[model samples]
Target: MSLPFKTLIKIERGNHLPMYVQIANELIKLIRGGKLTPGAFLPGTREMADLLAIHRKTIINAYEDLSVQGWIESLPRKGYRVVSDLPVIKPRSFQPKNNYPATSISPEELLHLPAFTRPGMVNDYQPGALIVDDGFPDINLTPYDFFLQQYRQQLNSGILYTLNFQKEEGGLLSLRTATSSFLNQTRGLNITHEQVAITRGAQMAIYLAAALLIKPGDRIIVSEPSYFMANQIFQQLGAVIHRVPVDEEGMDTNALEELLKTGTFKLIYVIPHHHHPTTVTMSTARRIQLLTLIKEYQLWAIEDDYDYDFHYRNSPILPLASADHDGRILYIGSYTKLLGPSFRIGYLVAGVQIIEQAIRYRRLMDIRGDFMMESALAALIDNGELSRHINRSKKIYAARLDKTTELLTSSNIPVSFHKPQGGMALWLRFDPQYPLANLLTNASANNLHLYGTAYFEGYNTNYNSLRFGFASLQEQQMEQAVSILAASLKKK
Candidate 1:
């Protein structure tokens, strides 16, 4: 009998890392470094778990990730085998000239900055999840065939290859120009090309904006309950976080002004149109008030309009940038929500002064930015495929949203939610406060992985809530998911 793989795996608890990823990465390194040769059969998950003295589920998650990523093939009864048939990993460019310095920064300093980490909810990021992930598009509706054809055309143009290696502020010209046009037509903003700085995604756009605008101990205002990720970014930038309460209309501008008078904050970040985590769109009057406050206080407002594309309800809302005549507001938009995240493109609309600073910071982070994907996306948008994709996607999400709402509401499940207009998700609150987070965490055993409102804030709110992204689940699947979730919630 072959020795169990657990005997081969060793973990140091002092490392403070998740056991699943630790084991997974070790296997990946063994394969990539060519130690684990092809066709090797690995130990069964339960056998390895027994040997490691860890949960069997942990081993399963590791195996699942490897399977989804095409690193291994699982055969019934025989166990898992290495997939040496997988192609060699070759990232876009930059032949390794030297090693990256792995230096340690203060934990305090590290805590306040945005992490490039993503939701590890899925085994592999499926195209379908793009609707739920702010970076994903409706994979079912995307015109891949047309895009592949256009990609080849752009590649043959010869301009794309040169553009791919440098972190040109605002991405490539062909791409930037196309994005600017889309912004103009959709949001009604009068912007010249020079003011737009393309970064990786909205997260990077927000990070660059916060890093440039906020200083250590500077005060900045955010919605009382807003995007957890954005809050993480602002806190990482060392901004003194002040949460201005938000209502149906949007951020409490009056409270914002009062906070400004105390001489506490230098910047205010608002989701405005379709405020994150809540799915409430701000009113036009509030937008005007915020712009006025920004100029009067001489403070900058960072607008994260992450999902302006698929307005499922009325006409798409205008971005705060559209109304910024004084440039006091920094507008951040992401193609990640509309385009594929592997594309890694987002833009910042701000005064030329801030744009210049952001460019310097971006270059410091990564010498070369994404070019091939940016170029391809630009061509897709230039040809109007992006708009079509968004429209089709919105319709599909809207239908799914309606169905999800109905299923959860009408089901025997003990949960309630508010219907959002055009976004991909619904915010839900469970009854009598079941341990939603823990339950969701444990529910992985049932093959249902969903998001729970655990990390939404620094402190515990003591409520059982969840944010469900309907974009990925089919209309039919939403009912079943809710049914399973309802049963999961009921379990003591």
Candidate 2:
């Protein structure tokens, strides 16, 4: 009897399982169900491939797997056939009862956790709409395929077993060592793998740094319009947040110095390069003065240089940690903005004592990062692949920023913005008379996505400004988006 190929075999492409594995498993089920009896011949690979609308290679691989498992045999001058003696396996007799156990914890009994408010940019996303992100990189420039190739090579070479199973909860030695060398060479920072704790991203680094440094009711200083996520982390740790004002030259060190003179603060958080939402680089004089204060007062600071690689106008100032001889700064950075957000590789550099404390806390939450990915990244860094990619991405992002500025200038919208010297976004301040909510709704209807005005909501006064990230948007898309924005303003 001939088998009905279409009715007997079905492959679900939407499933996480591979098509070939699904086919092989389905054939085993058919044999067990007595539909394919002992000594029955199977259909040809080509016929099955055509019937299923899949490639013949998939059928071949499935058949090979079945043959290896003794479910089928190949006869001379003939195709595959079901084996005479199918492996006898006892059927399961017990069924799991669906009743709830008395000891099981109910949802209502679970302890209440700390509450963190979701920001607008994190929640504002529409499918199939062109988005003006908040300082995100163009993911199209990421070399993921190359990284995948490196991963496969290491897996095949069987060298990842030892590389992954090391005792250090910090990170892979090779990656940390490579990162140390890279940071030292590029940013004028000196550090070793022992002083570096690899993290999933800058956010994780911030959380770890905050958790280790902050205690309940301890005062910590932050910029007024600081990175909101970092501020949230500090608040979650029960730290009293003292906000200072920022100017065109970056965080006002004068204000910080005055505060330190009369009062004591546990920690201060600063983003010196292309400050978030404002895109202002800190001046050299402020940096020197800030370092002097940190040393004199023995103050600890978290220096987050999230986008250190995309500078366009001139050479970026070295991080505060590079000049701190007294070890007062904990430097944090990530490759998410440089490579892609999906590549969650960030690092923290500090003194050995703090790194040891970070590692102890890190082990409780995460034993280690993805070693295979980290190893592959180290290989890329060693061979200069990451360097080349950064150089290429810098030029592309610079051009995109220039083009976006031109479009925004010509849009005739009631918005004023200064071209950012570095970083991926433009900070646009709308007239106080313009309605932000209406503008966002109208722009969404026009297929243009803009972040809601929730970023600067916690401030004393409502600052009518938004960071219009342009690195991810193409020239044509930028033009269309700005045009829609202008139309939305007119509609309002």
Candidate 3:
């Protein structure tokens, strides 16, 4: 039976997509929506062309595409029919609905009360305004031309269909393998491709890991000044968060051990290398102690090493996952920091079983990742471009860090900060006389933007500090920014 192909398939002549490809995609959607059942015969090329008022060659091309994708089969005498072997999917209306009403049910009405509050909208700065972001990479340093070349190559490769429709929720095998090798060589992690699941970013990796391990009423330990977003994720999952102090040695393992003795906790979230907000690397002794505690208490640990590549000082201490023998650590890292926040690519490394579970959980939200970008990144890693970029970035960022530190110290702003061993940002604390809120207001008036410190404040501790991101600013811009900050501080 010939369905109403004219009514079902609305071709957009103005769309940038080719008419043939659009028709093929529409047909596939109809088939999946059950309008065209298995073994249902389709109109011949001429008939379909006449029915749709398109060229016969266009109809033939669409049909051929469908056949190549296994959505349809051509019979000797019967023309084309939907493939009988296609899996039966739940049917939904294929027609586009116009002016659908907003959802009437509020989240609080449908689910548990006290639903997670939405975070404030991001501040939109003027185009030329200088922004002191919270540790973002300098996008100008990205090897985008090389990345684009690899992206084009992947798109034109013989495996284009496979790259477009890969079924692995964990991600492209090539990227995962390359990531496995890169981590092994650079971070000393003993992991295989099977132990890695690519995520949108480290944030998603953290969410997936938390989803896999956390349940309501479960206690999770975090440093006093922890990553707020991670804490919010745990809270949204109904997990109670406990705080341990973070001294110069990192999350005081002694304090955590003492807390562990007091109560049972499901997981510990630590940023051992370049700890967020404070930019303090956990001491080697503390890392060992934390790992030992994890082993002794049979607790899970999430080591978020987001900015491990830009360490300015001596060789970066190997991540906790590098020494994880029993699969206790779920290590997360991101290419966003290496490239920029705009590039959303990260991975979670754990045991094979843990990664398998993470992949399954990830599928509930994201079916698959960007295979083309992942493939391009794989090419970059395979060729030494990524490492070379990191090497160059370290020197550039190290110099900027020095310049910013020198300016801030020499200025009469009355601020104190430790020279970080590694990472992109410097943690600066102004004297109590200069309230961060007031400083932020004054900075804004001077056309300078700075991130707020309220998120880093804890129940009992108020850190009057902000993470001064120096990587994104050059020497002159840093000078201008510091001058603006000094002017802001001088305000009555």
Poorest 10 consecutive residues of model 2 by lDDT? 101-110
* TM-scores for every predicted model: 0.71, 0.74, 0.74
**Candidate 2 TM-score over all chains jointly:** 0.74
Top candidate on lDDT is 3
| Candidate 1 residue lDDT tens string, 1-492 | 564455566677765346775687677667666667688877788877887899999999988867755678898878898986643322121111111112211112223443453233546543433222332355666667766876676677876666655556556777777877877667766665666788888888888877777778888888878777788887767778888877778888888888888885678888976677767778777777887887688776788885777666666556767663366677898877775555567898776666666777777665545676777777677644565466556657677777877787788677666677666666666665466655565454455667533332244454455667777767656666766676666444
Instruction: Report how far off residue 145 is in candidate 3 (Å).
Output: 0.6
Off by over 4 Å in 2: 1-128, 452-456, 490-492
Of the two candidates 1 and 2, the one with more favorable lDDT, higher being better, is 2
Give model 3's TM-score versus the native structure.
0.74
| Model 2 lDDT per residue over 1-492, tens place | 678868878778895446987798788779878989889998899988988899999999999877755678898889999988664222121121111111211111111236654222235456767788787888898878778788778888887777756786888889999998888767776677877889998888888887878887989999878888788788778889998888898889999988988788889999988888688888888877887787788777899996888887776777777773466677899978887778898998877778877877777778899888888888778755576577667778889989988887777778887887789988788886775666666777777778622343456766767878889888888888888888877433
Model 3 ranges with Cα > 4 A deviation? 1-124, 452-457, 490-492
Clashing pairs in 1: 112-236, 113-236, 130-136, 164-371, 170-198, 312-422
The TM-score measured for candidate 1 stands at: 0.71
